[model samples]
Target: MTTNNIDILGLAEINVNKNMLRILEHMVQDKFKLYFTTEGKKGTGIRFLVKKEFAVYVQQFQHFEGRIGFIDFYTKKKKIRIIQAYINVQDKEKPQVKRLYKQIEHWTNQCLNSFVKDIIIMGDFNTKWNEYEFLDISHWRHDIFNYFKKHFIKESTLVFCDDISDMYTYIPNNPNHSHNKIDYIWCNIDLMLSAIDSKPRDVQPVIKTDHRMITLDLFMDDIVINKNNTQKCQPSSKTIYCYDEMQKTDGEWNWDKFNKDIIEYLDNPNIKLTTNKIRGINSHKQLNQLWNLFRKAIIHSAKCNIKQKKMKVKQNCHPLYDSDLKRDLNMLKGMLNKIHGTKLDFNDRSIENRQKIIAHITALYRRSDGNKSNTLSDFISITKRHNIIISNHFLHNKTFQYKDILQDTIIILESKYINATYEYKKNIMNTFIQERNQNYKTDKKKMIKSVLEQPHTSLSIDKVYKNDNNKDTFYTEENEVKEQTNLHFQMIVSAINCEKDLSQHPKWQDQYQSKHDVQHTIYSDLMK
Candidate 1:
């Protein structure tokens, strides 16, 4: 579990099932959303927890037989891929290790083919670096490094930290065992270079886990609206306010009509009072009815005021100036659109042209002193201000707060929202599968013809069995394959048998509870 402020969290091992996952979602649905892969039998798995703000941007998730989890998503229009893996602990499990690497290679190639360049791979490799006896390690760190290097990914620990080899990410409780760094975060070379800053955080041993959590922050250049503006585009807050538009008011409230309605309600003979409830009210149901009466009165007043305001003469505040500014902005965008429509190569000349147009637009909104207006520095500034106005109109207006009732309402609504979302995603996946199957059926003939024209074969092996002395070591191919298969199966079984029970003490719960309590208090206070 992670604090709500974190944008992304990667959890290596956890026992989570569909029902349990739904419960987790219900708890954090308002703040974060989850995507995961679980080993079915035990529900032991890895999960990628993305903050709600970033959930919509997650385009795809790839789960690899419960060993790896990958996500492809966009942030500020930048396509980035994240891969989290938990490798085997045994040294002799070469087949598993190779399979993991093959998956990485396949994913990297797939991303490249799709033109998504930036990638970050992180997780527990279960191997420590040994400069003197690298060959003795089961899950060789050198091989891992070499494999990543081939895909142009560099370990962030080594790239961003000094004396990287001396850093310890995992520490065993046993006195005889020494601490060593095995977990890692790797990023594409280009992404690293483009990042404005990158660093790692060390965890204290008191955290209760044998492996210290590794956190890396890679800040990229801010997205600016134009060359003339220096301001950055910040993401908007998730909290939004909505109000009923049909209840608009333009004049002062009709107090007489409102008073008459309240009088009639109070004089109704059907109304009853009982001693068990507060202030002679029968139950919460009666209190709610009174609250609704008050609400109706307030809304009626606002609507009457809105009608009066609508009758007044409208004011024209710099109509010509505003219109001209908007026209200039649209014309600039049109020019850019025309250039894009031409399908010209993105060479220096085209880029220069684009810059010139942007600068010209910036000049239109420049201040009298020949400096750009602070509010117009970025497009987001305008949208941000609009949102602020709307939120203020809804939130700052006088309102009532019923703590226990409101909290209960929020919990109920969140549960329904999350369940609906889950079902929606499930429906989308089902539709996609059905459509894919139908397409395959429709293209069967063409696919078969293409396959017949260019028959596929197994890829070439990098190494084959050989005799060092050039002696004849020939053996039956069938027997050799069988022996290799048996060896792989035996290694897997042995590794499973040797696996340690790494579950933490039940008392070692995530610090999320206290933090969530604080957040709830703050939110409740704000609502009040």
Candidate 2:
């Protein structure tokens, strides 16, 4: 719990059945800024705990009506958006379930439209498929994966590294339920490649939740540098100060006051100095000693000039924070929690009436004295008294589609290529088997001739070899060909449609060459 490994943590299924909210708040109080989004029902909610420094850069916090939300914040001076979602394990074919999927897509599409290119789509998706989960699937989940893939995003768990093996992030503690790798962290491919290590920590209970924490470790420099190639506005020069009022004063030169105050303090009867102590000290040491004596005198004189009441007030407590309304408000919230529980129902008429009464009482208490206290009760009372009229504004709000409309040509060509490749491979494999069986009784020379006569069959489907030399020639090495083909496909799709350079992109490289040396190097740094 005291480790320094994580900067941001996303948790799903907070199990609102228990007192997880208050417990979690206490657990991460001093270290993290905990934000929770729930439907205010049992067993539903997603929480994000971000470090305090990182929370300062947060520009937007969008909370949805379901178990999904996103926080767009800055880290390393780069505005990175992190979206966390929790898909319920239910009948996926249901209309409501399909609508949930659409909600995720709509939110993600909105994120992609933002200026921040480095986005992380992560959390408990509740899917079983692991390998190429985002690409090969053709169900309701397919839409989510396809959108990421088409936009050149890649799964962090799939990136090849010796330390990261295929393992499940979710394992029910109850022995009857089997483990599954449902939780995931999908980062922009470029951002993942720079990772020193990226994988799930372990399938363990965190705050009694049923999912493990996924970790991504990268160099600090990699996160801070802006590689998006976009112009950014300069940060504003503003200072926030919280200091004692005695330390602040507006005045012109007051040398006479300074000298008189200083001389009076230094000339007091209590002042004493040893002759031997001064005799033993050198010029440089003497100057420091004299300055310290004079500084103490100035401080003591300034303190004495302030009245007793003002000094006592400054010494005892903050002038702004002490109030009777605040005390009543705190007491009221504690009483409500004890009586009704942590989950308050704002929609219930009985509960709403009680809340209104409490607000009125607190407002009366604040108004009794001339003290200005912006208590929660004051706001509630004001809200009840004044309602903003939105008569015609609702008519203009239309249902505009947020789904990405991909180019027709790109979709047609991509579909054709996939189908063609599948068919070609199936036909070639069938022909190869038939020819080998048919030529069982043939001689070695004839068999060789028959196999060679078989129309062009090669494992490198995209590569073409020329018959220039007498010696047998083959396509490039297995790894090289695969890399080339992967790169080519990424380039074609990302270039023409997505406006992304796939070959040079970090995410693309991690996807195809997951087992490459660069990935190994990334994990090596993490291990160190």
Superposition error at 318 for model 2 (Å):
52
- For all candidates, the clash counts are 9, 2
Could you tell me which 10 consecutive residues in candidate 2 have the lowest summed lDDT? 398-407
Across residues 1-528, which tens digit of lDDT does each residue of candidate 1 receive? Answer: 354234677777675677888788788888788888757644247789887757887888887868788888765435688888887757676777777778877887765443324687888877775542244444343576676766667777676566665777777889799888778788875456444433444455434466777776655342112335556654343322222222223323444554555556555545523344347676888789877766765566445432332233445553322443333433333333343444433343454655543443344455577875531233324334323222323211311121122233333333443355456657887986676667578977555555457766665332234354876443347767556555556667455435433345334445323464465666556634
Residues 36-87, model 2: lDDT tens digits: 8746665468778887756676777775655777888765435577888877
| Model 1 ranges with Cα > 4 A deviation | 1-5, 41-44, 131-142, 196-208, 220-528
What TM-score would candidate 1 get against the native?
A: 0.41
Candidate 1, residue 501: CA error in Å? 77
Candidate 1 overall lDDT versus native: 0.57
- Taking all chains together, each candidate's TM-score versus the true structure is 0.41, 0.40
lDDT accuracy of residue 6 in candidate 2: 76
